[model samples]
Target: MASIFSRIVAGEIPSYKVAEDDRHYAFLDISPVAAGHTLVIPKREVDYIFDLSDEEYADLQLFAKKVAGAIKKAVPCKRVGVAVMGLEVPHAHIHLVPINREADMNFFGEHLSMQPEEMASMAASIAAAME
Candidate 1:
């Protein structure tokens, strides 16, 4: 069975996509830690981020950097924080969160419940801000 991330990439699942390239996909986190919080993942499924090949790891980071830049522009925050906790889903992924303080990136804390319209608007803004 495909991981949920893979299903999103394949269009079997809906996502508020922020950006994408041939090798990567960036989308909003449904249970976001903050507004404009996004998840970046490889189109190819890998259980662990470290398990990815050196080249794959480098490319993923580069793709994430672009997404982070866009997120910073689209979201109101001091900086965009990066986190790599891969336990939530089987697929390896990175979280790019807009944060004004260190505590804003807390993954264990309560997540924001964003309406569909809000998520759609945020995703569109981030995608437009992409370089």
Candidate 2:
């Protein structure tokens, strides 16, 4: 079965895309801990992050770094926190969270409800900053 991230990458579902290259895709999280929370995933549907080949794993990390840099430029944050909690979704992914404090990276916190327009604006801002 295709994981949800694969579905989004395949256009089976829509996403607020922040950035993408041939191997990876970055998009805003619909249920976000913070305003600029983004999920970066490999285009390949590998179930676990560590299970990926050496080159694939390195590419994912480098891809995530690029996304985090763009996010820091776009959002107001002290820094971008990287988290890889692969249990929620079967697909390998990295969460790029904008954090002013450590608590901003808390997965158990109440999520912010953002409109489609808001997500689109945030994604656009992040993409622009990447350029």
Candidate 3:
């Protein structure tokens, strides 16, 4: 069965996309710890990050850097933190979170609630900044 991330990549599940390349995909995290929280993942659907090949891992990281920059530009933050907690979903993914404090990146922190329109607007802003 396809993981949810794969489903999103395949267009079976809707996502507020931030950026994507031929080998990777990035989109907003609906249950975000902070505004502009995004998830970056390989399109190949590996179960773990280390399971990716050397080249694929490098490419995914590079792709994530681009998306992180865009998220920073579109959202106010002290820095964009990276986290890889590959347990929530079966697929490998990086969490790019905008933070002003360490707690802002806490995996157990309270998540923000945003309206669909707000998420869509934020996604557009981040996507534009990626250019």
Candidate 4:
């Protein structure tokens, strides 16, 4: 069975897309920790981060770095925090979170339940801010 990330990559699931290249896809997280929070994933679905090939891992980070920069510009934050807690989804992914403080990246804390329209608007803002 395809994981949810795979489904999103395949267009079986809809996402508030932020950016994408031939190698990777980025989209807004429905349960975002902050307004500009985004998830970056490889187009090829691998179950674990370490399971990815060397080039795949490198590309993922490079792709995320670009997205994080965009998040920083789009959202009011001290810095963009990167996290690779791969337990939530079966596919390899990275969380690029906007943080004004150290606590902003705390995944265990209460998350904001943003509406879809709000997510779309946030994604548009982030995409425009990408370097």
Candidate 5:
């Protein structure tokens, strides 16, 4: 069975797309810790981060760095925090979270919910910033 991340990449599941390249895809988290929490995943579905090839691993980080830059520009934050806890989904992924305080990146912290329209708008802004 394909993981949810694969489904999103395949367009079987819709996402608030932030940016994409031939090898990776980036989009906003529906259950975000902050206003601009985003997820970046490889196009090829691997169950663990360490399972990716050396080139794949390097490329993923490079792609994530670009997305994080866009997130910082689109959303107000002191820095963009990066996390790799490969337990939620059965696919290799990274979290790029916008944070002003250290506590903002708390994995166990409460998540924020925005309406569909708000999410769509935020995604557009982030995507634009990536350009």
Candidate 6:
């Protein structure tokens, strides 16, 4: 069975996509730690981020850098924080969270609840910033 992230890449699942390339995808986290908390993942499924090839890892980071910049521009935050906690889902991914403080990136804390319209608008703003 495909991981949920793969399902999203395949269009079997809906996502608030912010950016994409031939090999990577960026989307808003449904249970976000912050307003613009986004997840960046490889189109190819890999259980661990470190398990990816050197080239794959490099490319993923570069793609993520672009997404992070967009998030910073679209969201009101001092900086965009990066985190890697692969246990939540099988797919290897990076979390690009908009944070004004260190605590803003807390994964174990209560997640922000966002309405569908809010999510869509945020995604659109980030996607536009990517251009």
Q: List TM-score per model, in order.
A: 0.98, 0.98, 0.98, 0.96, 0.98, 0.99
Q: Score each candidate by Cα lDDT.
A: 0.97, 0.94, 0.94, 0.90, 0.95, 0.97
Q: Cα miss at 23, model 1 (Å)? A: 0.5
Pairs in clash, predicted candidate 2: none
Candidate 5 pairs with clashing backbones:
none
Candidate 4: what lDDT?
A: 0.90
lDDT of 5 by residue, 1-131 (tens): 99999999999999999999999999999999999899999999999999999999999999999999999999999999999995979999999999999899987878898999999999999999999
Give the alpha carbon lDDT tens digit for every residue of 1-131 in model 2.
99999999999999999999999999999999999999999999999999999999999999899999999999999999999995989999999999999999999879999998999999999999888
The whole-model C-alpha lDDT of candidate 3 against the native structure comes to 0.94
Clashes of 4: 0
RMSD of each: 0.6, 0.7, 0.7, 1.0, 0.7, 0.5
Model 6 TM-score relative to the real fold: 0.99
Task: Please state the error at residue 7 of candidate 1 in Å.
Answer: 0.1
- Misplaced by over 4 Å in model 4 are none
Candidate 2: residue 29 lDDT (0-100): 94
Question: What is candidate 6's lDDT per residue for 41-127, written digit by digit as tens?
Answer: 999999999999999999999999999999999999999999988696899999999999999988889999999999999999999
Residue 40 in candidate 6, Cα distance off native in Å: 0.1
The regions of model 1 sitting more than 4 angstroms off are none
Worst 10 residues of 2 by lDDT: 82-91
Residue 15 in model 2: shift from native, Å?
A: 0.2
Model 6: lDDT of residue 47? 92
